[model samples]
Target: MSTETSVTPSLDRAMCAELDAADPLASFRDRFALPEGVIYLDGNSLGALPKDTAAHVQRVITEEWGDGLIRSWNDAGWFAKPVALGDRLAPLIGAAPGEVVLGDSTSASLFQTAVAAVRLRPGRRVVVSERGNFPTDLYMLEAVQELLGGGEPLERRLIHDDGPTLDDVLDDDVAVVVLTHVDYRTGRMRDLAEVTRQVQAVGALMLWDLCHSVGAVPVDLNAAGADFAIGCTYKYLNGGPGAPSFIWVAERHHAAARPALTGWHGHARPFDFELGYAPAEGITRFRVGTPQLLSVAALEASLDIWSEVDLDAIREKSLRLTELFISLVDARLAPWGIGVASPRQSARRGSQVALRVDDGFAVMQALIERGVIGDFRAPDLMRFGFAPLYVSHTDVWDAVANLEDILSTEVWREARFARRGAVT
Candidate 1:
């Protein structure tokens, strides 16, 4: 039997083959070590391993940790990885050399940025954010506010729509407007440039959560006049799980913003052991604790791959992959109540598509058993992420074919597929 189906003309196997042939990023698939029989479509949540990562990790463990020991901080350049990696990543996100710093988790970075932003705009206690933002961003702000005080004493405003206007909430009383550049659930992208301008008009600082935007989208933090931003490397950047996250403070704010969680490493002169709390110059001041060596090593290995490719090319191929997934899935699964929840327009969507289906969890389980790995969110949303670096147009076609087979044969309707797990 042929792996062919009659659907939208653009979604056919022939069209996918043509797209694969024309793809500039086609060769990049070999750079990753994906399983032989699996079509991995969850790169938005956790990226697949790069082929070079294992060897790099082994060298770090054997040479740096075993042989160099404490001296590795100087000889192997271990102490400077945060700043050095930040410099390497700056170009990918359109930032300057001293603007970005790598450390901690996305939650920690958000808290640091939020605290600095509120402090910068003293007497203005309000933090404006969207209701649909990632839960961690909202929770972190709430925790920060509670630690400072109680009740509505520290105002927290939540926006509810995707419209162009935010001027209503961007008032003088608002100290910071914390926003995620790309909506995590719906995959809807916001206008970063316009939003930055609006927030600045009210004399309020903007702290962007680039967790979904950073490697997948073209972000010009400096050009957009953005004040602060934070993101994780495990997603589109392909850093391994639990890898350290990154934060960016514009060159102007580097000297002004003060980090709350100051540590010995962030001291101006660590060996001097000064009693007073003097911060290091520029972005170095934001480094609050000792860096995670193993995780940082993994992230550096991933960054090596990122340095070779152009982000614009990555964005182009990402859009093509998502478009193909949507076009194919809609034709095959719409009859079963699977509706597209992500933005249809390429410009307004990120690198993923969320399909709304009544039995999303079961459908996803069935697909997983068939070697097509995607994930499901709450309240009927099947999320598929297309990482252009390792995912190909042919992989998209195979994933959709597996979905069609599962739905047509009633394989997903089995009661055994409904068991809930700790993590999705």
Candidate 2:
């Protein structure tokens, strides 16, 4: 934010330009509607707006909904979009066809999958999860435990993160284990297959909350033998705000796990108007209510962008971006009392990086004022995301360059910066 100051900078813009030129994913930056002179490094929290998404939603609004009216559900293929979009997104996470579907938010999907997972193992009374997991997950598990066991409650075992793996936590008493693949605060990643194996060894079902890992990193749900997973669309997926979330269940679990929300759409014969409710065949049974057409249209358009993208290229660029950011921070801001909170090793980290600093909320505010947008968490942590599709090497360089001046001049500690807002 204080880049145009008295201090002479060392990190040159020319070197950053050269790096962007050679980057294979450089051309894809034009796909998003990025503003002039802004470096959007917060894509891991909320993704940049896709260029094509607006037009796609408009077509659905004017032609499909406005013109077709009630018939659009069948005629315009609106009802089938959730499944189609799920099938399209399945390959991105290494999931097979007919195993994934779209609807609701990540919180609701977590509740749905978790409820069914616990029910499948009827005899087991313990539900295991981490205290450091996303807050909604822990809350949902608590609710699921109460609802499932009726008057007799199931125990929700919360394992604190003293070390990596839950050696003593995974036992025969556990019925379901919920975990977030990539941690939100530190960006620490867990080994999916190894954890899955441990959960299964004790005959417990594994449910992964992929909120931070889905599109920004590699997640092979099927290859790793994942039982269930749920993730959001507004972040790395580049869907618009409040985009519908996705749910994936292994083909084997469809018959055994029941849908928690028994709405009309999930009924086998909705039009038949039967007196009793019947679950739809296969994955369709997970569909709870009428499909969210507008949000689905925006997400479907975003998925179209993914069809041309190679995840390998995206991942490679992502690592480079994060590496560059971390190196720059260590070189320039280390002496200023800033500390890296994220995993140092490339293989063990997510697409985002976090830094520990005093007055982190104000520092982020100062950075945002300069158009280098990032986010801040509670206590003292500043987070920056590197979404490969749009962010370039030069953008990363410019962000650090601005940060260097901000820290050196103590610009972040200004009285105006102390002001807080609702969202931050």
Candidate 3:
């Protein structure tokens, strides 16, 4: 038997077609409900809807909710949906069953896990996180600091590319370190196992925010020996808007882990009508309250598709797509001062690439108008996410081609594009 190897193909549209024809996951593209003529490059922000999502939600509404009503909590297994879905999601991130459970939003999950992680290490008063982390994570951490702090908030230390490296900030006083596995804006990935080792060596717990890495890149939380993790289902997971987040606690941590929220769902004997709260065993202790069942239904449908996916294959295709897009941008768009903002090395990059360009907000607006949809970050970064399940080599070529045409024509300077939306 021979091992197949990947080779870089020349820059050509016909070559892209050849690559697509040979793609093992090409058939999976039809499973998504993308609009006609729209090359979606924003799966990192919000995933395209799965074709089965609507029917699945509809069945849950008409049969489970409408017909079954209250009986559905048990008969339809609605009560167990969060833990059950977490078990299904475990494999994608190298987690074990009973070690992961769904939570509210990513912010809420971070607060839940961060508080518990801090409590695990008493006497340590400092929390470490990246300056580049998603704003919500930092925001939630602020609340954690105040709530846990005795009159004074816990000191927060930020590590950045420019100064005060992780080594500089690590000390005996650090309680927990929360960092995103893959940076949300620049698409840079961290060495999970290595960072875990570094944090643990200094007597600090490492909690990962895997929002961008879970479905797009290869992650092995247990293998990395991480203490805690939380990620959302709405992005590459394609669970639809406002889907729930999930939290993973190492089996070893369950015995001593104390979640901040003591909602009835986490109570060991909820139906007993006890006045006091006693958390349930294992991952169930992290649950705050009743889950959004309809949203969980949508996630359930998406997980069905994920059950058959190969993470290694997804990683391979992701690198291919990102590499292709970067190459095209460098070759064609560099004349307009557009440069790749993400790491050039595939090992250090995730499934998305960020491009640095002038007037990026307007340029992204123009790109969206032309149907090559990506997104813009605050100062000057245009992010393009390549979901291997749907985005193809041809899509990469077309996106760059569209971007080039927009830059050359100066259409991005138009008044309509300059108008900013509340979300962006």
Candidate 4:
């Protein structure tokens, strides 16, 4: 499949419609249950609902839960849903069947994997990560540091765009390096294989937080020789809100790796009710407790949609969509000082792009009001995600046209748009 379609960067809606018509993945858009009169570009934050999700959940509830009841754990395959779903999700990230398993949340999974990674190299005292990583990873690491630290907490070394690069901080003392595969705010992607080699060369394990990269980009944990990885399903995966996160441990680490959460579900003989904790063999060791089954059912439904699509095709459409958006923004919105915050290079970026503007929050609110739903990060970046399965080229054109009008009219300066929400 060609990642690039020959489309001219013209300020014409008809051209975009042509691109949409030619898009091989265009039919997949109908699989989603999107709202009418809404252009959803927020898949980086939360994915749009799959059309099959509600019916699938209803079936599970009525047939499995309502009818089967407790027997559903055995007959309905509830006990193995995490591992089963993990196997289904493996191909998207280039992982094997037994290497991935679902966990509670991205934060909990990070803490679980990070602790195991730190334990792997006992004497090493430092953990390296980016300063701009999603706050939850850093917050979870703080807890990991305190718990593992005998007298004093482990030293946390953070790399930044300004100074103290990864090469500067990496050394023999570093036990593990935890980094996001794609930056959430800026959408800057890292070379997974090269970074893994660099971290391992210093005798440190690489634990990738794939929260932004998993469904948005192609990831190969084994191919990169990465030690651990964790990601959420609600984003590009289109799982419902609060869906379970997943953890991937390299096959090499399965035997010796010891996660911090030693729930009975992860016990070697979970049904035996063993007094002492014994971690289950393989990825099952990562399971903490009884999973939120309804959420898992929702995720399982989403996975059906994923099973049909091709990752390379998704990547191709993703690049095209982002490229179009960037080109349009540069050509039309430049006079208003709107800047692309993400990497201009397609290879160095994920599926999303960030636009830098002074009044990003208010502008995003205005855009949301106009039915162009993207999101804002902190002080200035307006983040837009392009899920190739649903987001069309014409949608990109309409988004930019709407944005151009908003900036030109100064509608973003209204008092109502300025009223901040607790979530944003």
**TM-score against truth, every candidate:** 0.95, 0.96, 0.98, 0.98
Instruction: Compare candidates 2 and 3 on lDDT and give the better one.
Output: 3
Candidate 3's residue-wise lDDT over 192-270, tens digit each?
9999999999999999999999899989999999999999999999999999999999999998999999899998999
Better structure of 3 and 4 per lDDT: 3
**lDDT-based ranking, best first?**
3, 4, 2, 1
Which one is best on lDDT?
3
Model 4: lDDT of residue 218: 82
The C-alpha local distance difference test score for the whole of candidate 3 amounts to 0.93
For lDDT, candidate 2 versus 4, the one ahead is 4
TM-score of 3: 0.98
lDDT of 2 by residue, 5-103 (tens): 122236567877887999988888899999998999899888888899999899999999899999999999877888889999998888889889997
In model 1, the clashing pairs are: none
Which parts of model 3 are misplaced by more than 4 Å? 1-10
- True-vs-predicted CA distance for residue 380, candidate 4, Å: 0.6
| lDDT tens per residue, model 1, 1-424 | 1112223644577778887889888888898999999888888899989998989988999999999999999999987888889999999888999888897999998998888888888888788899888999999999767654445557888888864347667688888899999888878899899989989998999999998887898899999999999999999888899988998999898777877678777778877988888899989888877899888888888899888898889888888788778878777776776788998877888888998878889999999988889899898989998888888888888888888888889889999889989988
lDDT of 3 at 152: 100
> Per-residue alpha-carbon lDDT of model 4 for 1-424, expressed as tens digits?
3233333556589889988999999999999999999999999989999999999999999999999999999999999999999999998888999999999999999999999999999999999888998999999999988999888999999999997999999999999999999999989999999999999998999999998887788888889999999999999999989999999999999999999999988999999997899999999999989999999999999999999988888888899899899889988998998889998888888999999999999999999999999999988999999999899999999999999999999999999999987887
Worst 10 residues of 4 by lDDT: 1-10
The residue pairs in collision within model 3 are: none
